[model samples]
Target: MSDAWSHDEVIYPELGRILSESQGERNEEIAYALAICAGYAYAEVKGGADKVTLRKRLARVGLQDNTCKPIELSVDAMFIDSTAFVVRACEGKVAILCYRGTEIADLTDWLTDIDTEPETYSFPQAPDRRNWRVHSGFYRSTRATWDDVMAELASAGPEALYITGHSLGGAMAAMAGVMLRKDQDPRHRQVRDALKAVYTYGQPMIGNVEFARECQADPFLRDNVIRHVHRNDIVPHLPPVATGPFAHFGTEFRYLNDPPGLESPSGYWRRNASARQAGMIDFALTPWEFVARRIPMAGSLVARWRPIGAKIEAVADRVEKAADTLHVPFGRPPSFVCYSIEDHAPHHYIAKLATPGVLSEFERERTSVS
Candidate 1:
């Protein structure tokens, strides 16, 4: 185990208190805490920590009274590879299931992510079981662990359940949420009712339009599945809708990096254009800045010559203004072409959510809703 995970300080202070206080309601605090859990799921897999150790880590973060032990499940079968962990919080009043994201070194994970082939999706309660289509890889992965996940949920018997994951895991989390909610088994009714929300970060589209419509038609699924897309994160744009029957459903909360604020879907393109323009300007200025720093006398000379400096600044400003006028229409170049993979890192989501500004906005919105 790494020192970070082993440290005594609470990784997520007041998470238990927040979960208990919320009483299964979806709130910013719960979402923030779950993001931490999702990130920890990655750590748990990477560090190869056993359940006892994982429980200790969870306890350190304030999930102190988990009578139901944490359970980690790993599945590696014909094109289906995934790792996930389930644990109870607030004395089993809340259950959290976190799926591990794709590891760069794992070929199987990459294959699973890129497998865009569509497959027939049929659940007992699905409105049009025969016509529903979903990503083949994600479907298989969710199916592989469905029985085990349901069994754990039954054992935990939580009043509210939160499902979360990052990257590829996020995709599976969405699928699992749908499966659980659509399950017709009377034995799993408690599991379905206990599902408070599905939270995902940097997730990709998991199903076709028909499947998406199914999610939209269902009141609970429509309102509770929340997707967080970090600024210019590339993963969420995978398996392009133009290339396949893939589509994304549920509410989305997009966080912008530049100026650092939440953005609506309608404003995504404008924000992307601005961010891209800023990046371009920065790239253009870097060479000059580097040369000025490298040539010590050059910087002094530029400073001494006010006209030359003023002229340079004026030209740069003009360029920036001209760039601002150039609009990059949504889906013109395609998001994957311009997005940054680094923005999709799990830590970014964790850090962004914990930021005071973002939390304040979330809190204000929550308060308004209440």
Candidate 2:
């Protein structure tokens, strides 16, 4: 809606409206969208590009450069350091924490190593304050990413604290929300209270049924977490309920490119969801198909930063093995394949959000004015 992005034909009406003006949480929503752009920035790093390229990539996506240098931080969690997890602020108010998705070089292998049956871990800052538990793997990964991100978020004192990612990053973003929401750090009570919204795309279930239930059972926490899942995207349903009882948290926004009634809901999708639809995803990925179609192309067109080569064959083997496991007892459920690799692309998400028709009435009005 700003003259800056007027040239973009597929304006994200809601996002466009937010960009044009400042009001209550308008900037907050805009900030969340910007976080997705930043998430892609981290994802590009997986291809082994340098920081200058990262800055250029951010600019290409319409993000203004940050004036403050100290706030640009990286994660050092148990899984990965720097690139895998990063917190960057754009346009001042929106403080975004981005978690990078999986990459071919150890990316597929790392995902394959994820514990099917995740244990529960208590918050290190809990006990004396509150008793909350999270997926063992997610909690450990969060600590490794940053033990005190909650602390930093509180100190920022922004109107909204936006946490986001795609694929694995999405799951981590949700986990980060859980940790911050239940944070017992007396000093961070403000940050915990300051959380306004959480957005994730193509993310998987970060916890089991218990985790989902706990989050849904609470009204305050429930409203703040929103998930944008492309219909039939299997990445959102992985670890298959067969291997684990993992379920998702947050309100679901299901969009399949012009599907009727997929508009913003007045309530949670889980409580109001209709029957499942047939999957358009093709789960049959041959070793060659993965290496040829999935791996190298995982990096978006914006950057050629890929970790490619002969090692990809090994990663492709893991992909086949993962496909096998996606089936029974320890693999994917019969319904899991309903979601496919094509639905998981981050660019598609950005494109979908930008579609003009998805805008609300107010968004449309703003578009006319702009």
Candidate 3:
């Protein structure tokens, strides 16, 4: 088993399917369907994956993958697509549910609203953070697809559940982790009740301070939620900690080097090594630098509109400081700074988790529990 197995494979093999690239045809009936697995799946969705192909790749993993066919979640809501699959590997029955991330191509065409509007969400069953508010856009997108995924999982029999996603999809995966923990769906309450763990990559802050503390204290989340942030990728700091009160939720795993087993096939170690030798530009950027880089990414698409209090000056300081605080505690100095967008790519995560330092953290926890 190579180091790229980010999660403790003994406990979360299904998730391994999400991180590995497939190496063959979906119908090959032999080994991996492609060189890259879900990484290739990510490319299929600049619209969405061809259902036939996705199902085939999933089948190769010894599981059945199903979707809410017309999850047709309002395009207005970002929940572009959803899939539910059941793994009957040696680990017994484990179901995995995932959300497709923001279609960058989708966002490229539309203007984005960055305003922060704190709003309460109503759920029939009270969750740990009912007062919980979320990124309005993300929350809207989750509305339908969550129901669809939950409904499917509901019908699927009791099993340990593993929830995950990357990027915007990562944020939604976090929320589904929370929602599933609640008795929201009586039908699959057993499965939800058994949510084993939540693994999200490049996720953004989903709610305000109240929701953040709520999740921090929530028993289910305290032990299970793991957010992986690569050196300085920009999305994680978003919903701007300075703007209002939106805060990130979960325990963060930050890695400076690649995880032991999973080395980048292209030998990214050399690239990162070369970048670091030039003064290790991997550290966090200063307020001005952070904003300078961030602003350009938003480009002309993001409205300069701030909801009343989103003063550019005030928020800048808070976001910068918050980045330092959240990123500093877990790793050493070089791991702190984030220099490029490449840091946000799953390829990097796939590489980092393959290393022992970060990957071992997960292995240790699973070992302790088992």
lDDT of 2: 0.50
- Model 2 off-target regions past 4 Å? 1-32, 43-92, 123-134, 151-155, 259-337, 355-370
* lDDT tens digits, residue span 1-370, model 1: 2333223445446676666455434466566666766776665434463466546546655577654333344444567776767888776787888787787777777888878788787856754446688998888888877788788889878887888999988999999989888888898998888787898888888888778878888877777888888865667766654447566788777775344355422223111211111133332343464466357797666345534543454455456556647853322221112344666888777766663323321121122221
What are the lDDT figures for the candidates, one per model? 0.66, 0.50, 0.48
- For residues 54-132, write the lDDT of model 2, one tens digit per residue: 4434443344453222122233343433233333444445555666555445543254226444656554533364334
Please name the candidate that would achieve the greatest lDDT relative to the true structure. Answer: 1
Candidate 3 residues lying further than 4 Å off, grouped into runs, are 1-41, 52-72, 77-92, 108-115, 122-130, 258-339, 355-370
TM-score of each: 0.70, 0.62, 0.59
**Candidate 3 residue-wise lDDT, 172-262, digit = tens:** 6787777766545457668766576676767777777667767777766765676666655666766543446577666665544333564
RMSD of each: 10.9, 10.9, 12.4
Task: Name the 10 consecutive residues with the lowest summed lDDT in model 1.
Answer: 269-278
- State how far residue 210 of model 2 sits from its true place (Å): 1.3
Model 3, C-alpha of 204: deviation from truth (Å): 0.3
lDDT measured at residue 86 in model 1 versus the true structure, 0 to 100? 81
Alpha carbon deviation, residue 128, candidate 3 (Å): 11
The whole-model C-alpha lDDT of candidate 1 against the native structure comes to 0.66
Highest TM-score: give the candidate number: 1
